[model samples]
Target: MSKLDWHADRGTHPDLALLDLAPESVDIDLAAVRLYRLGRVRAEMNKRDIGAVILSDPINIRYATGTRNMQVFSMRNAPARYLLLTADKSILFEFTGCLHLAEGYETVDEVRPSSTASFVAAGADIEAREKAWAADIGNLIAALVGKGARVGLERLNAGSAIALKAEGFEIVDAQEPVEMARSIKSDEEIKCVIASLRATEAAVADMRAAIRPGITENELWSVLHQSVIARNGDYCETRLLNSGPRSNPWFQESSSHVIGENCLILLDTDVVGCHGYYSDFSRTFHSGPDKPTDDQRTLYKTALEQLHHNMDILKPGLTFREYSDKAWNIPEIYEPNRYYLSAHGCGMTGEYPYLYHHRDFADAGYDGVVEPGMTLCVESYIGATGGREGVKLEQQLLITETGTELLSLFPFEEDLM
Candidate 1:
């Protein structure tokens, strides 16, 4: 397989010496890209008749405002940050200590300090503090949205929802609008994703080189983590680094379990790389000094086949339902632990257009058309019913006018194949 050519000479940064030239001389302007994203979101909102949207999800906030501060903390604690987007204004409700960070960002129309009371503070009435927080948010909503006016809300806490309802505002699910807007990426967004994939693939190379017998799973996992951070990337979203027996059933996080000789090592890099774009892909490796057993080889071959089969069928204008109907049928032996979908859309993180298998579509999938400019991660996990281990493989791709373009370039283990 041909690898992706990363153009290091055409860097993301503009040449400083060309500052005297006209603004149009710059090839790419990230600030303009962010504005384009915000505009797309607003257009989606307008199409849905959503007068305003309250965003608490960090990714959503970043998409709307292009500000990254305390993202990890904000994900766990809802009160840490939020963004309120109205037709006429955009406001950021920031945590007490982080308000200063929001300043000078062009996307933010206003930055207001969020509530200070901790949700789990000792000796404090948690319920009362929650009510107070809700009241504050309600007041803000009341000011923007008239009484009984409909507003969009994305992942609001129960307390806040109740408060908004009591304040006479109609709440609507706003996540779909944002998700739709994010489903198809812009050129700049694709650039960021490519940058992230480059860093992640490099890290995976480091991990492959460092893998050896007797190394604990946690130690091996840290190799990828360290490589990513050392290159200015962000954190890995999940701890899906496992080996040996843990690789059979899948979904196992890294642990202290030592990798024995000739064990199967399964790894998924869910790293949020440069500029917070996510690079998600999985690979299976064989621990050295012995070759993979026949069973292991069979599992690996089957998984790789499934991954490629799914990838080969992807094309522009293919609907989710159509793709599901035509997707590769899993053999009976490997059906027990089959993943929910053959592929999922990826940008900042796994987002929309989740392409499910035929059997699972009715229960968990939605219908949508695959269009140009969308990125998807094809996935596969193959292990027999009574097998000792499984193989997990994934690839990231970009949908084009004619077919698909591979974004991930990590090679499969040729020995196992």
Candidate 2:
């Protein structure tokens, strides 16, 4: 349905108030997005001389072929369903009775019943199942590439890996190609990102509107969940909302603690939002009947400074190390509790190219150049090791040919500033 029609019909629907405030629906070409994304993965695979890739990671499967089946369930259930992509053809091994899920998608060339080998599916017959699964994979690889070719693989169980190896295929890490392919965005993909961010921010607004002096952290967080689902977005990947002292350490999931007057609440939108794209930005709110304290304002300003400074230096061709070298210097007191990544890549989920802080780079860093069309989330957290509260801030932006374009439009709490 058109955005206006949907909104008008749901204008008074109590559960959909956030949809009414969402930006008008964007026009996205689904076929273009599917084709472009599939082509990217294929190009990367060919560049690496990979004969075939077996993708079981739900995110990778979705990225490679625009088809999703039991994403969260399939994540933990190895080889429940997977895709086999060769340079010339695309084949999906779907779970039984779910073959229809991939029908008519231009990205998929064929769909067949998956060979179930995971213990949950096979039980005591797991060994026999593994051998059978390997045979199925080997037969396909032999037809498409040949016996003993360099095959790529994503997350798989040890038994499955051994089974593939027993088939004489040299398994290589396929994530390298898949992630590299996903790092850059097409115009069509960016349209979906924009729509996803709009939906997420609308939910954020509803969450913020619901925040008051006495609401429980879980109650406040549920507002966002309701709005995102009501807008047709998928589930959030995190429960990252927290209030008052619970916000100090960061990474604490939402709880039932009641918010108090003038205390700070922090949220990270690790949402698997519209079209399976992620909306990962953070904000800290002051639940106020009272003005934010001096300590709160200080934390907010510092985090804002860190976020803006990193975003300002982003551009195509900048190496990851160079970006780290020029990042805003965090005060020593906050170092112990700082956010691990200064910035990271974003697409279907928190993805490739994790940019580490200068402090952590000597041991934990890797080098890569930023490229145009890459979407990134710059992050900041300001709280001393023993501090009572903290402020978390993040901004999602597109790294353009010349500079950066901010994608998230949620306003920082002005009162805290």
Error of 1 at 293 (Å): 2.5
TM-score of 2: 0.94
lDDT of 1 by residue, 250-368 (tens): 89899999999999999999998866788999999999797888888988999988988889999999999999998889999889889767899998889987889999999998898
Cα deviation in Å at residue 239, candidate 1?
Answer: 0.8
Report, for every candidate in turn, its global Cα lDDT versus the true structure: 0.82, 0.89
Q: How many backbone clashes does candidate 2 have?
A: 0
CA error at residue 388 for candidate 1, angstroms: 0.5
Q: Per-prediction TM-score, please?
A: 0.90, 0.94
C-alpha RMSD (angstroms) for model 2: 5.3
